[model samples]
Every structure is written in structure tokens, then in C-alpha cells.
Target: MGGGAWKRGGSSCRPTTTAVGEPVVLPTVTVEDVRRVGLPPSTANLQPAGGHVVLNVPVNVYAQAAPVTRQVEVLGFPVTIRATPEAFTWTFGDGGALGPTADPGAPYPAMSTTHTYTRPGTYPITLTTTYSAEYAIAGLPFQPVDGTVDVSAPAATVTAHEGTTVLVR
Candidate 1:
């Protein structure tokens, strides 16, 4: 056993001591705390609205990113937690998926995230957002949360249609 500050099990907040032997307790927000804050999931959108796309064509996909803050009580202290989008994962519903990258993607003419479908079929698109959090207590500086929370947006279905070559006059 090491001799140092002893922390209570399952408690995220760390107890600190001031210069004058006074103990100051600051709340440490955890992943679960952020989840409890009921953060809103990013809105998943697809280009060419109505969920229709051309087969074998790159379809643009992006997620709306926003930071959310809420007040909650942790260890009997009022704490403010802010969760911000840090990464994203796009599932194209064809065994194809995009990474947990920082890119939140953009609309057409700036297609940061895109995927091409090989076959013509209906596919469901989903965006999973990873959020990084910070906590502020009693007018103190915001401290980073130890872990991140991943929230998946409601699935949007997209249909890919195969187009045939036609002779034009």
C-alpha cells in the first residue's frame, strides 16, 4: 500500500487541501455523469434529400455538432458539465463504416465524409458521436473528464438506385 491521498471507491471527485489546512472538494464528472445529463445526439443527414442516391456514387454524410452543458449534483455538490463532440463514426449499413475521427463532415461542395454503395438497395445510415466532457464546480476552472461518451443518432434509411445508360438525341 502506498502512502498518499486516499480516495473513496467509485467517487470521481478529488479532495484537495488549501494552504491553510482547509480541505476543498471538487467534483469530478465521469462518463456516466455526462450520460445522466441527457445530452442530445447529433442529427444525421444525407445529401439529395428523400434518402435517394445513385448507385456506385459517393454519397455525402454529415452530423450536426454542438456542445451541451447542464447542472447536476455530484457528491452533494452542484456541478456543471459540458459535453462536446470530439469524434464520429458512420455506419453505412453494408458492412461498411467510417472511423472514429474528429471530422464531423460537411455538405456538398465540401464532402468531408462520404461513402459509395456498390449495389442498389435500401440501407440505413447511422452516426455515432463521441463526446468529451469538462466539469466546473464553485466558480473554479473546468476540469477534463477522464473518459468519453458515445451516443448514436436515430438511423436514417437511404435507397440506392441503379441507373441504366440511355441513348440521347
Candidate 2:
């Protein structure tokens, strides 16, 4: 194992293995570790600007998703963790929600993710981003981290208004 072992300071390091001969990576990267990195939350965006929309109509919504990479020490070993957006969940604040989907939606016209308001009122919009992570130790090949982490974006406010009919002479 001399040729394949990693050199740390002045000594050689090797991965431990279980009785069955499976490599047991020490300090395995976990969802908690990824969360501890405090990755940036995706920002929720809406079309039909000014925080207002028409009643009974579809409003466009999307997220500005960004991935994060960080370097940390796990049990004295240099570890690299990378978190990528894998899913998104949205709440329209009107008791309507869309979610856990791969599509982060798009701006007007694309209509990738839209919600229809049946009444005229004010609502708060929320988006939660789920990230899947992978980690590498000492420049070794990366390994998938079990489970995922969810980060909530800042809440946004929107008002849906009903149109009134007007007569012209």
C-alpha cells in the first residue's frame, strides 16, 4: 500500500476497511456537514413585477440556483465538498405549492413553473432548494454524500388583484 497511500506531513496514510474488505472512508461526508458549510440559498424570482399579479391568472416563478464548493478538514484529512442544486420546492403562500422538481422554472413566456391565484389578495412566496453533495479527500476521487440538504430562500410578497369592468361611450 506504500505506492497508493497518501503522504501527510511525514507519514503515510491509507483508508481503513471493514472485515468484508470494503473501504471505510473515515469521517464520511454527511448532509449535516454540507449544511454546516452554509451554502447560499437560491433566490425566488417572479414575473409580472411590482409584487402584483392579476387574479385567476398564471404567474411565472423561478429560482436563481447556484452551486457551492468548499474545503474542509475531516479527521485531519483535507476534504473538498461540492453541493449542487438538485431539486426545488415552492409555496405560493395561498395554500398552493409546487415542488421538489428538477426544473427551477423560468421567466415570462417559458412558464416552466406557474401558479394561478383564484382570488384577489396578498401572498408570500417561498422557495426551498435541495442540494446533493459529493466530497473528495486529499485530491482523491469524489464520493457521493448520503442524503441531501435543503436551504430556504428569502420570502417574497405578491399581491393578486381582480380587474374591474369599465364602460366607454
Candidate 3:
């Protein structure tokens, strides 16, 4: 009880137990607490992960993050929260938008999250990423909060052109 008790400025799991020795689960974090402790999701300088994709093909787009986690004091408990990519919404810049893909999308030919160009042209593609965060306190289990953050990537151009095919007679 002395060494494992949770306290301020501490960063470890300190599980609480009930009178019957059953593990006491922390209540789901309140919506207000999420705003207080979690940093808004960020998609730094959004761009297609791979440049120069073909028309009518799947292109992979992704965001970069370094340990997307945050530590903050909630109410009176020190809490740790981690942000994870939940979905992606893409605007193809051609007056068309594709969206909310659960898959992070693969490269051409293997992309589940992709769009097709109808004409040969240069289009600016914009992507919005939705991030979901979970919180853990006093070594307790992590629980998802009713929090989400959407970050948009700067529009990057992807040129799509038609392939030429001529018959030799």
C-alpha cells in the first residue's frame, strides 16, 4: 500500500481495488476532461505519402507523428493519453471528395483508400485525419474518452494523365 499508491506527479499504473478485492475500474473520463488534457490531433504538413499518383488509381496518404501521447493532470489524478489515427477524409480538389476511410490506404494497385481521376489534370488533394484518444490514470486500464480531433493536410497536387495506346497497322 505504501509503494504502489497513486500520487501527484507520478507516472505509473496504480490500480485501485474494492473492499472485496475486485479491481475498481476508473469511471469513463468526462468530455470536459478530454478537452482539458488532450492535445488536438495534428497532421503536420499533410501531403500524399507518395507523390505523383496516376488517375483512377489508389494513392496512399499518411500523417507523421512522434509518440502521439500526452500527460496531464485531470481533476486530481495524473493521466496519460494517447492519440491514434481513426480515419481519413480526402478532398480530391476536383470538386470531388472521398472519405472517412478506416484503412490508411495503400499504394497504387493495393489501395483501399483511394480516388480516381476522370480527366487528365493536376488536382490538389486534401486530407483530414480524425484522431481518437484514450486515457489511463493511476495504472488503471485505458478507457476511450468522448473526444475526437480532426486535422487537415495542406493541399498537395497529384497529376493525372491518360495513357496513350496506338495500334500499328
TM-score for each model: 0.83, 0.81, 0.59
lDDT of model 1, residue 167? 100
lDDT of 2: 0.83
Judge candidate 1 against the unseen true structure and give its global Cα lDDT, from 0 to 1. Answer: 0.82
Better of 1 and 3 by TM-score: 1
Model 2, C-alpha of 106: deviation from truth (Å):
1.2
| Candidate number with the higher TM-score (1 or 2) | 1
TM-score of 2: 0.81
Clashing pairs in 1: none
Candidate with maximal lDDT: 2
lDDT of 3 by residue, 57-157 (tens): 54555544333677765546577777787777878778887667765565445545556677878778777777777778766678776767666767777
Q: Which stretches in model 2 have alpha-carbon errors above 4 Å?
A: 1-25, 165-169
| Candidate 3, position 144, lDDT | 74
Candidate 3: deviation at residue 113, Å? 2.4
Residue 78, model 1: lDDT of 75
Which is better, 1 or 2, measured by lDDT?
2
Of the candidates numbered 2 and 3, which has the greater TM-score value? 2
lDDT (10s digit) by residue, model 2, range 1-169: 0122232322223576569988755556766767776688898899888899998778999999988899877678789999999999999988999988999998879998999998889999999999999988778888888899888998999999997667999
lDDT of each: 0.82, 0.83, 0.61
